[model samples]
Target: MAKPIVSMINVEKWYGANHVIKNCNLNIMEGEFLTLLGPSGCGKTTTLRMISGFELPTSGVIRVEGESVEKKEPYERDVNTVFQNYALFPNMNVFDNVAYGLKVKKVPKDEIAERVNKMLKLVQLDGFGKRRINQMSGGQKQRVAIARALINRPKVLLLDEPLGALDLKLRKQMQIELKRLQRKLGITFVYVTHDQEEALTMSDRIAVINEGVIDQIDVPQKIYNHPATRFVAGFIGESNILDAVVVGRNDTGIQVGTEVGNALGVSDDETIETGDAVSIAVRPEDTLFSQERQPGFSIRGVVKDHVFVGNLVKMMVTLNDGTEFKINRFSEDEMIEPGQVIYLYWEKEKGKVLKTRNLVNTDSHRDIKGGDEDEEEGYAAEA
Candidate 1:
């Protein structure tokens, strides 16, 4: 098994009276691409800064290679950072910028030239050594920043949304390039980004943070399919969440009485028992719609709207109780119009039953399911 290259145990950070990172625990494996993903002000950038030595935690320990790095300066740590703003020397050419680290160390002039040339080639900027920083495009400048950060031969590379400034097409292209580079170099990468698709495309593992809380950390497929919490389910992808109560256990899994209707869900939480309230998260892609009722699915809804996007279609489904559910299907499938009644169903395994931490109560007859609905503090409810 690969050992963890970086570890954060019970890490917490604060700014004056504001508590930012709260009781965070993470393990970044060696030579793996791990992403810190969240929305704005969710502490993803702050977490990256702490790892890079720009910020210090108020409590807990951060270790690199089994050694404490709390007191180490950014330059002293075995990591290099690439910022979103491409912090290259505007006064110097590409070769000079890439060779800055080697020059600062007073390395032999001959060795510096060789290393700079090789680094530029590794970033696919081989012949642009003599070009000025202002002469490069956004993508080219980002490549230069990466080349500079890597030229130092650091054990780990930290990138804080390095592709954020580029256009959509360029960002997608850079995602593939960055992943390929990380795999080739075999260096641990601690990347920070709020973009879900980017994290899904580039990371070996993704840590989803919300309001300083590390909610879920897992592989892309698992994170998308088997979200451990309600926040993770709605954050990583489009999901149809329904309030449910555990009715009973069966051979396939547990049975749940949801707001829409009775449904079967994969029972992942052993602590949950009959009568306990839970949330059922089913992805839009997993949901199936038909004009007739289907087996194993008892939910009924009316098609409220349909949106066509290139090869896929997004549907807005309103249940009998007036809750809206979203569904995604291929554009090639049979189309259904507004106000048409449709039966919703999915495989038992497709539904993820998550244990909610906090429940909100109201005067309505419907029993509130367990979930944190503190949207004012960075948590949002998904329909």
Candidate 2:
């Protein structure tokens, strides 16, 4: 692999008694959309601030392009940040708002005008330059802010939830626009967002941060399909994270015994013994239900409830031994009612075994029986 554009080694930060970031090490390649993703207060924003020079690490080395830059000021670094709230000048028009940075550096008037106009066109705000900052819509204002940041042509752009303040429809629109813009410019983007759907939609790779440490870092598909920790299985998407013990192993796959019965299992590339403790992650989308019991792989469960969510139907089922799993059915597919006994099935390979969740030591599992202990911790719902 080529040298990373940015690298953090053994990064640690503390605010008095509170330890914010703990021994975080990450390498970000050039021109890739890397997201610092987690719930609120998980040190995602803190990490972003450290990278942008708003806050210094208590102990760590932050290198940009192989040069340690902890001593550099924000302006000295070859980067720019776009805040959640559009920090445009209320007194200035769109053109002037996008030209502020160039004016600060005393760039030539003709070049500033040319660059500003070209950026406005690039962001689809060519004729809106004459509009006042207060007069533009929320999305328009955001685009103007982006145009201003890109006018400087920084090596990397740091966006702190820039689409957060928009309405849902506009937020979705901006999400697509932001990803398109990144590819068009071919610049590295370090995005920070608590919205899992937003991160999944825009990030090339996601760094799932928790309690000041990174739990997993991989492409969006791998992060969702093969989560490294139980929290990630629950946090990235809706999952059935069941506590199980390894029962047997073979080339077909390993078998794990749950409270209910022994079921076909899958795991990460780690070695596990017959008596080892593990958790199996089965996504809602991967779950299958049938009226006829599957010979040996199916588990018997009672349907507790079902809800229609647009194009998908979410059904909650509890096993005979009290373990619960949520299965998703398409809106056009067969329907099952509450109190109905059904057999839930899934492919063995779809069940991923996550490593132990002892680092954070908090249950991130969503129980089908209805007690959610992680509610107050700001755990987000996956798309």
**In model 2, what lDDT does residue 323 have?**
79
Q: State each candidate's clash count.
A: 0, 0
261 Cα displacement, candidate 2 (Å): 2.7
Top TM-score prediction, candidate number: 1
Candidate models: Cα lDDT each: 0.85, 0.82
Model 2's alpha-carbon lDDT is 0.82
Model 1, 213-311: lDDT tens per residue? 877777899789878777788889889888787888766787888767888789556777887667888888888889988876789999898888887
Our tally of clashes for model 1 stands at 0
Residue-by-residue lDDT tens digits, candidate 2, 1-383: 44478888778999999999988778888899999999999999999999899999999998888888877999988889999998889999999999999999999999999999999999999898889988999999999999999999998899998999999999999999999999999999999999999999999888898888787788899888877777788899789877677777778787877776556767764556676666778888898878777744657899898888898888888898887788887873566878988887778898886434423211112111111345412232210
Error of 2 at 338 (Å): 2.2
What C-alpha lDDT, on a 0 to 100 scale, does residue 210 get in candidate 1? Answer: 76
Instruction: Mark the 10 consecutive residues where model 2 has the least summed lDDT.
Output: 361-370
